[model samples]
Target: MKMRKARTPIIGKLPLRKGTIGFRLFLYTEASKRSAEVKKYAKASRIIIYFIDRSPHLVTGNNIELISLQFLHRQSFTEKIEQLSEEYDILAIVGTVQFEYNDIPYFSLIDIFNDDHLKKLNSIICKDEPYSEMIQTLENHLTMVPSVSRLVQRLRKVIVNLELQLNVNLKEDIVIGMILHMAFLVENMKLQQPGRIFPNMEEYYNSHKEEIAKVKEVLKDIEIEYDIKLTDGEIAYICQMCLENQQL
Candidate 1:
């Protein structure tokens, strides 16, 4: 996240520790004046992206702290990346910014690496170019908040569908929470078997019958689309979310 004055690499990779959920941005440029001499220096670095979930860390660490520690020890950061590639899932490769290769998906530096917004890290080094925001957006995608994660890509459909079905224009956090809740429902609906009673649903149904009805309609549509039936209790649970999202 810290900027180096020397024009080394214009694109910045994600600043992440071991066991974190994100990726490293590797830059590739068609050999220009600065990089023409370096061996294996294509225009851009082929990035093998990965994401892993772990127990949350304290939100107090800075990206530079890790880099400074690595500098002090004179450790090879590339070696660490190799180790991690073996340890975790390699999600995908980031193809060129403009071209859509047959195998690799393209990513843009302006969205993922910029400093103006979505600051998972406190800083971004656009000394010439930046890549952190790009990786953070990818992280959001892997985390199921695809609206922020992919930056106006396929998740826009998910947003539009949810809004249309549920009849609410959700704020970002609510959208995230709703998707996560849906994920949980999908995972556990079979085990939980959905007949267990929660009194909150009854209160919600009594007070907000209209939203409760909307939840049933939406859930029916979801069942038809996804080919999975949600129990009445599940419908009620999401109906409660509808009420909450409306308040937000």
Candidate 2:
């Protein structure tokens, strides 16, 4: 599908690309900043949800980077749709008002919660409803600054403590992924559960013992703050994130 001109109001009308990470839904709204509706879709889709202001033009600056870190594991670019709509490949514009254009789907907030609209949304994002348990956990952390920035600092601190260097892109991308991972870990701890067991964990642990030790040490602050112990599997998962982000 072809996109309208850059000057046009509606944007990101192109068809979904093969093997793309996921849709970047521009959720235009004049409501309160960080509404529950915005959080719901964002957590469900596990992708970037750019909250639009009253005007059609997009908001820019630090908020974009902050929000992007909140849902960064997918690696969605957070450029303003007005400037790079075509390249952004936005999935749709969902908001309280519906646009007249047919370039892309416009989902009204009124009917967005309806079963039919939700099914279409799922089809577009190529993911089923997020597990109910996980959604509850995400809602709890969605508004927490510590969940995004503090977790990022913890991971970056671990990298430095280990005397490792990571490229700029990987460093940013991995921090985003790690934030999401840690959120789930917190949830699991609340339920007296553990993260998924790593296969051949003994061998893997033997190979990366030093890295694992440092990761656990850095994560102690989070554990203390949340009053929850970190399971061995959780430590392994975090170690893998650090390793993947390391510049070899």
- Which candidate number has the best lDDT? 2
Report, for every candidate in turn, its global Cα lDDT versus the true structure: 0.37, 0.47
Against the correct fold, how does model 2 do in TM-score?
0.37
The Cα error of candidate 1 at residue 140, in Å, is 16
Q: What TM-score does each of the candidates earn?
A: 0.34, 0.37
Clashes of each: 14, 0
Which stretches in model 1 have alpha-carbon errors above 4 Å?
A: 1-159, 165-167, 190-192
Error of 1 at 208 (Å): 2.2
Worst 10 residues of 2 by lDDT: 60-69
Candidate 2 whole-model C-alpha lDDT, 0 to 1: 0.47
Q: To one decimal, what is the Cα RMSD in angstroms of model 2 from the true structure?
A: 18.9
Error of 1 at 91 (Å): 24
List all candidate RMSDs to the true structure. Answer: 16.4, 18.9
- Compared with the true structure, the alpha-carbon lDDT of candidate 1 equals 0.37
